[model samples]
Target: MQNRQNQIEPEWTIIKILQWTTSYFKTNGIDSPRSTAEILLAHTLGFKRIDLYLRHDQPLNVGERNLFKSLIRRRISKEPVAYIVGSKEFWSLELVVSKDVLIPRPETECLVEEALLVLDKDKVSAPKRILELGTGSGAIILAMATQNPDQQYFASDISINALAVALNNARHLGLDEKIDLFCGSWVSPLKENNNLFDIIISNPPYIRRGDIKTLQPEINRFEPINALDGGEDGLACIKHIIKNAHKFLNKSGTLLLEIGYDQKKAVDEIIKETGRYAQASFRKDYSGFDRVVCAKKAYD
Candidate 1:
């Protein structure tokens, strides 16, 4: 067999393969090369990431090497690692994902954190009704349900295919029964429903439509366009949610939204313009960027 250096090799061992793949990924400008190499190799060998180091001396058979090679090729083309592996760990839960939905992001955990804070404060009363819009992969709702199981959970998505992925993830996480899934844009499906939520949350598409192509290739090329396009100013979804959420929120209900890093001012303005929410505020992500916005419905 040909080795990484293109010379003949009797066998390709785990350590050698990892070293080769890491160098190759680096040369190709792939991020986190060593970690990517380990993830792909571990997946191919049916081992955990740490297991790869433990079995460093183990030899990869032809079949295993071929599978690893295929994954590497896909990665080199900029397909997301989550899509390649078919799952992503968000809030410590492995969620199913696809091109139909935006991959669950770590920054979105800020939204979950804010949501949990709201839920915690309301726990002394009866179970609070909670709703999440654009619930891709059910990440936010599921994470909240996992932590605060006493609340009533509901989630909606515009894309049926995206909802399917979220539903499957919910089932996998055993949260299917906990969250009621709906298919429609924003709060459309809930317009006729009598239930008013104590908390409404979302991590909507906020990328400017024209700026979608400017994002990283893994996002611009591979992820769903509908899940990324945020119209001319990247606030279409945000505006819609802010304007319509009042109809579904109980008096003084909280709205928590994950926003673009630079959107604090604009979103703050939108919330103020509607005169529906007061004390519009923001929470920063680990990177110190304003990643989540919080506001409460203005009581009449």
Candidate 2:
């Protein structure tokens, strides 16, 4: 029991804490043990991961040690590091996150990549206008604006809390001036405006209600249900977006959406039935899953 007591002690150094946290996470079935340990420790120390290595042997003081222990305990309970650190890196930007918004997933980057491709193909002029629906952390829209500085962007979410988080991220990334934001259900906030976008992108909620229970505890338990629960079959929001998107999209605008692996056929069918889109196609993510669907509105 003495060994157990030592493991829980707060006096551990930077290196020792790293070793302990990694082993603890691994024993608890966390797949990315070492990386998780490094991120959590770096966050607690207010230093970058590389700085942590440079100060490997340095001891953490009482305050720092206590904070590290608190974060370690939360991790052991299966809390996501993004929640613990209150930020996540997406598209090379560290964006703030919380229970109010879904943690940005790496796969969602494909949405941005797909958007850039569509924009390039169309050869949109400078200051092209873009709209993003369900902009949880504002990661997708903000990343695009950051890359295409001349692009004007707008982001909207159904959750007011989510819009707040997205707004904060916009401010932190210095993209606030370039991006307009709104709150309310999809299309509601923009209905009165006649502004047509060159591209519309989204990472809407896609998990089926029944499947939520099967997700990892860090997600199903801690993440907001409204951000993950996609009505009965997970296609509710996607269907709504597809039906109304044409009204907001310019004649030649593109719609880029992130979908679940099994959702490709259903979403594809929806796009086909709409009859307002052309060249609708799916792009696989890094994991080889059919993840992003791109469709362009007919020029007519």
- Specify the highest-lDDT model's number: 1
TM-scores vs. true structure, each candidate: 0.95, 0.93
Q: Model 2 over residues 1-300: C-alpha lDDT tens digits?
A: 979766655457789989988999899898699999999889888899999889888877768878888988898889999999999999999999999999999999898998988877766467678999999889999989888888788989888888899989988988889888988898877763396888888888899999999999999989999888788999998999999888888777888889999999999999999998996899999999999999989876
Give the winner by TM-score.
1
Model 2: pairs clashing at backbone N, Cα or C within 3 Å? none
lDDT for 283 (candidate 1)? 95
Per residue, candidate 1 scores C-alpha lDDT tens digits across 110-184 of: 889988888777756688999999888888999999998988999999889889999999889888899999988
Instruction: Point out where model 2 deviates above 4 Å.
Output: 1-11, 124-126
Q: What is the C-alpha RMSD of each candidate to the true structure, in Å?
A: 2.5, 3.2
Worst 10 residues of 1 by lDDT: 1-10
